[model samples]
Structures are given as C-alpha cells and as structure tokens.
Target: MSGARAIVEALEREKVEYIFGMPGGATLPFYDALWDSKVKHVLVRHEQLGAHMADAYGRVARRAGVCTGTSGPGATNLVTGIATAFADSSPVVAITGQVAKAMTGRNGFQETDVVGVLTPVTKYTVQPLSAAEIPSAIRKGFYIAETGRPGPVLIDIPKDVQQEEVEMTFPESIQIRGYSPNYPVDVQDIERAADMLARAERPVLFGGGGIRIADAASQFTAIAELLMAPVITTLQGKGTFPEDHPLSLGPIGMHGRAEANRIVQECDLLLAVGVRFSDRSTGNFHEFAPEAKIIHVDTDPTEFNKNKLVDLSVLGDANRALTLLYDALLRRLAKRDENNAWLKHVNQVREELKGIPAYRDSYAELSGPKIVKLMRSILPPEAILTTGVGRHQMWCEIHYKVLRPRTWITSTGLGTMGFGLPAAIGAKLAAPNVPVVDFDGDGSFVMTEQALATAVEERIPVVSIIINDRSLGMVEQWQRLMYNRRFVGIRFQNIPDFVKLAQAYGVQGRLVGSLQEFGDALREGIRSDQPSVVEVPVSHEEDVFPFMPPGKGIKDTVYGTSKEMAVF
Candidate 1:
C-alpha cells in the first residue's frame, strides 16, 4: 500500500472523526487516500483557521485534533495556530506536506523545513525519511500530543514519501526511550499541604486550566468544599468551578472580579492547584499573595519556582493530586478547625462587590461587558462560549457565568486575535448538540472573518457576537491609560460593515442599535439553524476595568471613572 494509504489507515485506527485543513500540491496524494476513508475532511479557508479549528476540537473533545496544510507558506501559516495550541496546552496533531526528499537543500518548489519551523511550538516534530516510518510517526504524534502536558505535534511528510509504497505494519504500542508522562503524588506533600489548609484562618483555592485538562473539576470542587475556602479561577480555568456557586469568587487576576482580587489580598493561605502563576494572574508577582503561604500543586516540575515561590509543592497529575489531597483532608478533618470566620468574610466581600455595580447609570448604550452579562442571563446552561483575545475576551471572562468545565473556551496564553470564530466552529463540531457562541471584538474578528464562509459551507450553526468598537479596543485602552491617550493606529475611519460582510458570506446578520435590539438579535442568532453574526456598535472609548495598572500589584487596581461612585 502507498504511504498515503498507510497514513489514512493509521488515522482510522486512531478513530479520527474529522481532519480540518486546506488542500495544495504536495498533499494531493494524501487527499486522494483520504477520499476512500471514513474520516470526514473539513476544508478551511485558511491554514491558520484549520489549526485553530483543530485546537478547539482537541480542547472540547478531549482528544488530539488533526489538521493538515501544504508545504512552505502553508506550513508557515500554521505556525501561529500551533503556537497558540502549544501555549494553552491544547492537543493537536498538525501534518504538513513537504517537497520530495530528493530535492533536499535545493529549495524546491513549495519546500520548507516544517520540522525546524515548528520545533519551538510543538511537543514533537518528525519528518519520516521513509514510508515505513509513517505509521510510527503518526501514532507517536497522537500519543505525545494528547499525553502528559498536551500540545501540538508536527509531522512533516515529503511528497515522495507519500507516493512511496512500503510493507505496512502498524505498531500496537509505542515506547519512546526517554519519554515518561505519569507522575505519582507524594503523600507527604499532600499531608503538609492539607495540614497548612486545615490550620489557615483565611484560605483561598486557586485553580487553573490544568484542572479542566485533567477532568478533575468534581475533585477540585470537593476539595474546595472540604477546605471551605473561596475558590478563584484563572482565565483558562474559568469553567472548572461554577461561577454562581456560593464559594466561588470568580476569576482573580488582572481584570478579574474586584471581590476576588480583594479576597486573595486578605487570604492567609493559598492552595494553588495546577496554576503556573502567570504574570497576568499574579499581577507583579512580588506582591501577589504577600500575606499568604502558597502550596502549589502542578504536573510540571519546572513550574515549581518558575514564577512565585511556594511553601510546598506537589508534583503530579491534577486529578491524582486533587484526589489524594481530598482523601487526606477528609481524614484530618477531626483535628482541623472550622472555617466559619473565613466563610463569613468571603460572603461579605461577595455581597459588597454585588452591591458595587459593575456598570454605570449611563450604560443605556450597548457595550461589551453589558452584552456579555446579557448573554450570561440568556444563553443556555450547556452552551459553549468562545472568545477572541481583546477587551471583549476580558469582558466575557469577567461577566460571563461559566457553569461547567470545557464549556468556556478562549486563547489564554498566546492571546491570539482571530481565534474565536474558527474555534467556535470547532467547538460546535466537537459537540453538535450544544449551542456555541463567539464573543469577538471588531479588530479581532476581521482578521479571520473569512472563516464565516467555512461555517456556512459546513452548516455549523455558531453565533458570533461582534462588539464593534472600531478600534483595537484593548490596545487603545492601554494607550489611553499609559501613553497619555496618544492613539496611533488604534482607530478605524472606514471599516467594512460586519453585518453586511456576514450577509455576503451567506450568513444571517443583525445590527444591534440598543440593549433590546441586542437581546432580540442574540436570541434570533441562537435559534437560527445557520451561522449568524450580530454586530453591536459599542462605545470605542469604553474600557474593561478593575484594571491592574501595568507593572503594579493586584491591590493597586484602578476602578476607573464612575466606578468610584459605586456603593455596597
């Protein structure tokens, strides 16, 4: 059988249901082989969108999503998408076609070093020298991409190799000599951490994306209840704990809930689970959790002292560590003091923040945060929400109530701009029964607005709520605050009407002029059986607040104008 056939057979063995990609010269043979296979192929408008689609699929499906691109420019186009997946620890297997192996170093047509280009952004990069190695490479790619710290794996297959015939023998299991993913929890570490939690006067639980990746939301919730600590989720960890829960303090970091930030400031002990303590999460890091003793639990050993130092470190899978810690804490309950005082304080903070209005009295105008809050009130409980990186992303993180894990999706680390629309398509494909919505800023949406055509063609009914601010909203806010409002390339004079653009792509479109219009449009978009875009013209000057000033501590956050008038 041909190498292309062998590749398809290996994918079939892996039970790959879909492959999102674009077709080109070097990949013709592989596409031909795919024609005879059961694996459904989703042709994307761009290679980058294909990668984003695969990344979202991986995050939602809990499996390695597959994406393909042609050589040279096509491979390079997949770079940003792969980096985004790598940064967020999403499992994706990206395959890129290459020029013939015999054309080595000659700079053959459409030739590029796919392996070299993708090495920094991928868990593994392989270029099989022969068709015989294709099966092993493909198998190992999937395994590596999904196991341990999940990430993208790049497999560069040359054109000749795809055309070559080889006696195929698929490996049932792979053993990479130096690769080991499983890590057992240290009981002593858990005991020490539990003891710290038990003795603390004010303890807070900090959860990150790792908890969701480990599928340990239940265990995390149990631990939170056992400690009776107020839980604060990182941006990537938003849905791991129900936002409406009594103990939930919502996200704590830059642009996080004011109450959550204040509670973290007052906590005496912080039990950080699977959180890497990114700068955005920690503010200035030096002053973050200054009053607290932090017990950090994570799978990666290198993350131990990479950011903030910890009083104790538990190195293992989030699920295993959380399970053990929960069990250990239950045993130590008799000796531990009750957390009534801390619970009362947490409740007070929550009530105070609730009374301190999130919006101004003049918010009759349509704005991102108001839209996000409206969606939270209207969106189905099981609906999956995705966001492009910007002010709108922060608005969703702050105002959107995420009730379950894997239901909230966004680019947390890389903060890719054009991630929302395509990612929403991938999320919808992964779970067709659930409603999907993408909260996108105007600047971010236009970068990959072409993806709407793909959704229309594929019949994916994802709603895109575009906050049309006519500027790079986040950067404009930063420039206004830090650079004396000297905005350079921030404003757009004449832009394509997003509603008209969507209509041109055969998508249902709506222009929202008021709050009532927005609600009507959103409901219509949600109920529609086809892809739709809702463009909301918002104030270009509106800012996402509870803003932590650049290079400042979390406690030094600026409440912005009109916020000072807020009362509790």
Candidate 2:
C-alpha cells in the first residue's frame, strides 16, 4: 500500500490509458510503480517530447492527456510542451515528482519550485502533502484541465509523499469554489446572437480550436451554409471545416491568406465560435475587424474582453450554444443575407494572389502545397497530422484538410521541435485504427531523433515524413530575406541516412528521390501497417513563400516564396 502504488491504482481506476514522460531521480518511485501498472507508459526521448505527446494525445482522445517528470529540471523540461497545450487549449495533466518534503525549503538537490514557475501556463496546480489526497488532487487536475477552455494542469508529488502509504479513493466528480464548467445559456442571448447573424449585410464565421473541441464541425458547416457566410480559421482551426468548401477562407490571421485577412476586416457581422482572438490570427487588434459586430461564443468568459469587443456574448459549451443558435435562427424563419457582393470581392482578392495557397503546381520541384496534397492522398480520412514548429507547420495548416477536429495536433504555442515524432506515437496509440503522420523538417526531427527507439521497442505504427533540408529552415528563410542572407550557423551537415538509421531501430525506412518516388513511398508507409520513416529529399534551396518577415504583421507578407528569396 505504498503511496506510489496508491497513486498508480487511482490512475488505473480512472482509466487513464496512457502516460507520456521521461524518468529522472525524483520520479523514480512513479517509474517503479509504472512498471507494475497496466497503463501504457510512452518513454519519450526528452521531457519536452513527453509533453508534446501528451498534448497530441489529448487532442485525439478528447480527454486530458497525462505526462510525468521529475523535480526541478525534469518538471522545467516540460514547460514548453505545457505552454503549447495552454495556448492551443489542448487538455493535458502534467505530473511531476518533487524532492522530499523535509528538504523542500532547504534548497535540496533537484528542488525547483515547479508550481510557482508553471502557474502562468497551467489551468490549475496542486502540491499534495498527504498521500490520502493524491487521488483527489489527480481527479481535480483532470477536471480542471479538460473542462471549459482546456489546458494543462500540474500535480507536484513529493518523493516522500509518493512512498507514504494511505487509503486511496479517487472521487468520480469534483466541485471547486470558483469553477463551474457547465454554464447556463439565456434564451435571450441566443435570440440576440441570431438577430445579429440575420441582420448583417455581410457576415463571416470565424472558427478556432474551440470548434473542434466542441465537436461542432457539422454545425459550423451548416451554420456557414445556412447563413451564406464566409468561414475563416485560426491556425488551430484548420480542417474544422473542409478547406475545399466554397465558403471556407483558409487561415485568416498573420501568415494567413491575404484574401482571408481582408475578408475578416470587411465582414459586417462575425460569428466567432470556440476560438480566441489570437494576435497571429487577428493582426494588430486596433485595426482588426473594426466594422464587424461580433457574437462571441466560448466556454471561458474571461476571454471575452481579452481581444475584440464582443457585441453579444454567449457563455456556454460551443456545441450546445451553436445548436441552440441554429435552432433559434430556423425557428424565427430568418432569411439568409444576400452577401454576394462581399463574397465576390473576397474571391477577387483570392484570384489576385497568383498562389491562393491551394494545391498548385508551378515550380519544377514539389511545393509545400504539393507535399501536403500527396500526404492527404496516402493517409486515411481519420489519420492524425502532427507537426514540428515553423513554416512547415504553417504549410500543413494551410494545406492538409482531411481529418476531423482533434485529428490535427501540434506544439502550437511553444513551437517546440523534437515534438512531432513522439506526439505521432501518442496519437497512434490513441487512435490505432487511424494512421498517424508526423510532418517535420530535418532540424525538427534531429532535435529528438532518439524517439525512433521508442517506436522500435513499442512497435507503434507511425509514419514520419521528414521535409529534410538540413537547416533551421524557418529561421534561415527569415535571415536570408530580412537579415541580408548571412546564413550564419543555420546550415547543418553530416546528417544520418535516416532510412538506415531506422533499420538500426528495427523499423522500415525509405528515402524518396522525387515526387513520384515520394508518392509511392508514402503509400507503402500508410499501407504497411507498421512503424516507419520516410525521408523526403527536398531542395536545401527550397523555401516557403508568402513569408511574413519577423516583427512584420501579416500585411507585410511576401506575396510568394521566390519574391522573398533574397540572394546575398
């Protein structure tokens, strides 16, 4: 009846199927207990990877993903991953083993005050003093992390507390003083929101991560079509509605399509669902959609006033609020607005951009758009798309549009590398029936390449498509165009033969030479039903266009890549 065993038993009773993390000194007890537990432990090469895996797992599972770390450095290592979850509203529970209680205030080894440092990132944090409270704290952590606008929660367990024996009974439900996940929606509010949508000359539907979390994709599509409104998404909102849909306007903020941003600016009425007004997606707040009369629906009320002013606020679950609003609109016999003039204007803007960021072919080599298209063709509709940070992630966000909500996962906030592979594994485990693809750059892959061993040992089926160019491609692109091409130390050399390296880890590997070869290679990986790696030989000279220079807003974006390809 040790504390570690009690905690493990509680986790089992709660049916937490997976836990992602690395082992460190203070966390030895939990690791020892993990060995004897039935829950699957995904051993990531780094704590950062562990957090990313948990974040991705949360997105796919529609539940709180769990991760573990040791005291001090171990806990701190997970900061980036946790921050990503926080920014993106990906639910995750981060468990860290702390130094013994007696040494807590004495500056003991590996004694970093994690709860203090992580306050800004986590939805809630608990440092349980008694083993008896461990289960309660865990239950509370999950409830807090997964409810409302989801984010990561932290639980700090002292080494001694972990070893102490106590009766363990995790509560099935929790009640916090200031926390109430289920909110009441007034009928009048829904009426007002409907009126706002119906009275508009030109309306736009702006969706975010919340749309996916609320499982309102169909609702979103229906609302957009019924109201005859244009739809745009934040980065995390890609694929919330099928990109091919006529009403869909790709990602709409900075680095977003020029037309999408313009549409956001011009729309008279904006129905924002399950999304925050992120700076990247809104440009400068002052000039952002000043004309739009916005109806904001979100689980978090605090977010209402954080950005664009809300003309009407509906505080409720996005799915429920949207359903009610849809019904209300229909009940009122509302007539959809004739926004054809606005739509035509937006389409004109889209046509003006030589490359609409759609699947297009112009250059000799495959473009980022082409890469995502080929990948979509290979993977099933339900496959999970994971990515490392940088322009590559943006490319996928712009192009890959197959899956449903929770299907696309990444380290959005921290933009951490070494994240994609480990996260792909977590995703595969959560949705074994679906293919898990990690779209990453060579620099991103190398940051946590050791994850190949985890794939080897666990026999987890995942396909890693490395957009290898052997450079911090994103930064390199920025420096080249904005900083006089003093490439500096951006270039990398002596990289491994990823295919052979996969063999070392007991997994299948292939190096693709061209688009045709890449197509075949991706097909084999998607069909093989086994863990594998595919290295795509992209041009080191290749760069993502439509580049928005660092510090410059979306308006300052390069119309296309070649335009920004500065030669020193």
Best by TM-score: 1
Candidate 2: stretches off by over 4 Å: 334-341, 348-362, 548-555, 561-568
Q: Write one digit per residue (lDDT tens) for candidate 2, span 238-276.
A: 878877787787777656766677678888998998877
In candidate 2, how many Å is residue 197 off? Answer: 0.9
Steric clash pairs (candidate 2) = 545-561
Tens digit per residue, CA lDDT, model 1, 45-131? 899999999999999999998999999998999999999999999999998999988897799888888888899989999999899
Off by over 4 Å in 1: 334-339, 355-362, 562-568
For each candidate in turn, the TM-score is 0.97, 0.93
Clash total of candidate 1: 0
